[model samples]
Target: MMQSQHPPSNYQNNQQNLDDFDEVWVPNPLGQTQGPAATSGLIDIIKSGSLDSLLTNPWLVSIFVATIISVLIGAIATILAGQRSTELTPEQEAQQALLQKSQNLEQTDNNFREYLTRDDNNSGMVSNPGLLQAATLEAGARYRNRIIASLNNPQNPAYNQHEELINYNSEIEALKRINLGASGKEAQLKYVDPSTGLWVTIPIDSAELAASGLTKLNIISNSRRETTQRFDLVTVAQNIRKILSEVKAARLEALRVKGLSPVASELEKTDWFGNKASPSEAEISDYQQYKPEPIPANPNTSKQTQDKPSPKPTGGQDDK
Candidate 1:
């Protein structure tokens, strides 16, 4: 090969001989020498409108920065989404279900509390036996049909965990069986005729009923108070309140199993149990002091007891 005797001026600055060169040398922006392949790639970038605008145009620089930032943000968001979409373990699922059941029980208890504490007479006590009985039946139905039934449902993870609910169910059922007349319509009176061994229902405002002594009949019909094992609204309410405490404790335990704490709003509410004792003297007075209103006199009514002929049991046969 024929070699050049004189080197180029650029090679002279670097003190290099032309005979040592394998290819022409080119300087990049970073002051580094590049091969033909690198030079070609740089030209491609320039032709693509990247190198010049990215380095000189402020708008282009801003757009480039924004693109890089958006890419990083999207990557981070994908990672977070993967974590959030992770499924709960079987144990976690059980704990979550139990917690939900207990919370529902607690809410029912709160509703019962509101109904039990209602005082229509405004005398600081619920001095209306009729209203009181209605409240008790309502609370019992809620606990049995709604609360206990839900807890004992086969689909519930915590099913069969609360056996006490079954006992309550029995107690309410017994009360319902014994106190049939108490839940009758306010406009009617219900009584079982001993002579005919049948139930007789009569309108409260009927002159025939007034003649039959409706007030006395009501007292005799609602004689469940004399039973040895009778249901009391105040007592039931107090028991339900205690049940709320147990439910809260159970929920707290479920949270602990899941390695979580009760939220700030519930910390205080679940921290302590509430009154579990018998209803107060005031509460007892609510029912004990009840006075039945006197029925108006019917002049045509007979002083003698009129035995109603029984055909079949009537009145609120529904019982509930």
Candidate 2:
């Protein structure tokens, strides 16, 4: 017997087995005794360590973070670029302004044409009531001045007693019929106050004055009588017509030069007078409702109305 240091029977056998197992010590590479191995594969080391003990590799984290940052930056840049592209630049703004001006001119021209045709029931050849009045007053003053000058000039046949005087008196009488302001004593009393016994002037409305002026001119133009000197009056009227045509043509040219063709064209074609020849209610309504197109450059491509002087009215009642 081996001195029986071990327990008898199977107990001794079990102890010997335990001792053999204990003597066989296996080496652990990750254990404290071996210290830490050079961490080569980061994934493997992380998998082996405790949840909290695992090292946070900045490089790996940075890769994912950088990708996200790049994506965000790209998104912001795209939005800014889109915004920049859609915005109107200064050149575009200028073009738009020119276009608008052309349109306005066209509308104005259309209205003028309509007034000239006398299509609207209103008189004085102006679509704008206020403007018509002003024009009337201006014409009245001009005619008065011309008459006075002719009378004062000794060289003028109408200075003392001539056909011109008779014509002038007739024109004056016609103007008085279409008077914009009160006539005779009423007009003079405007500046005087009867209630206060003081000199109080009542200011005339600008629109009213303008209408008066235009009315005077219209009357004078319509009241021309055929006389031996009718040709002279015809020449004067023709000159005035030429001046008006020149002004209109210049305005159209300006619009065209500015590249506002559409507007200018609209203005050129516009008829200021509604259908005066046909007095249908529907036609009148249509004229009132009509809105002219914007002005385009070169509104009138066609030749202007014949500039030929009108034939003088027969003098002395044709002596037939």
Show model 2 residue runs off by greater than 4 Å: 1-145, 149-313, 316-320
**Clash tally for model 1:** 0
Model 2, TM vs. native: 0.23
For candidate 2, the C-alpha RMSD (Å) to the true structure equals 23.2
User: What is the per-residue lDDT of model 1 for residues 1-320, given as tens digits with 9 covering 90 to 100?
Assistant: 99879876766556555345423233443455566753454455567776664487565567779999999999999999999777778888887777776676667656556654553432223344333444443444444444456576899754766645554454555444334434442245555433333344555543433333433332232322222113555565555555554555555555655556644224424322221233231121123322432222321232333355323323454534
Scored against the true structure, residue 281 in model 1 reaches a CA lDDT of 19
lDDT of 2 at 143: 58
- Residue 136's lDDT within candidate 1 is 44
Instruction: Name the candidate that leads on TM-score.
Output: 1
List runs of model 1 lying over 4 Å from the truth: 1-70, 73-75, 78-82, 121-320
Candidates' C-alpha lDDT:
0.48, 0.48
What TM-score, computed on C-alpha atoms, does each candidate reach? 0.24, 0.23
lDDT of 2 by residue, 28-124 (tens): 4223253333343344456668454343656556776999999999999999999998788989877877777667667756755544443223444
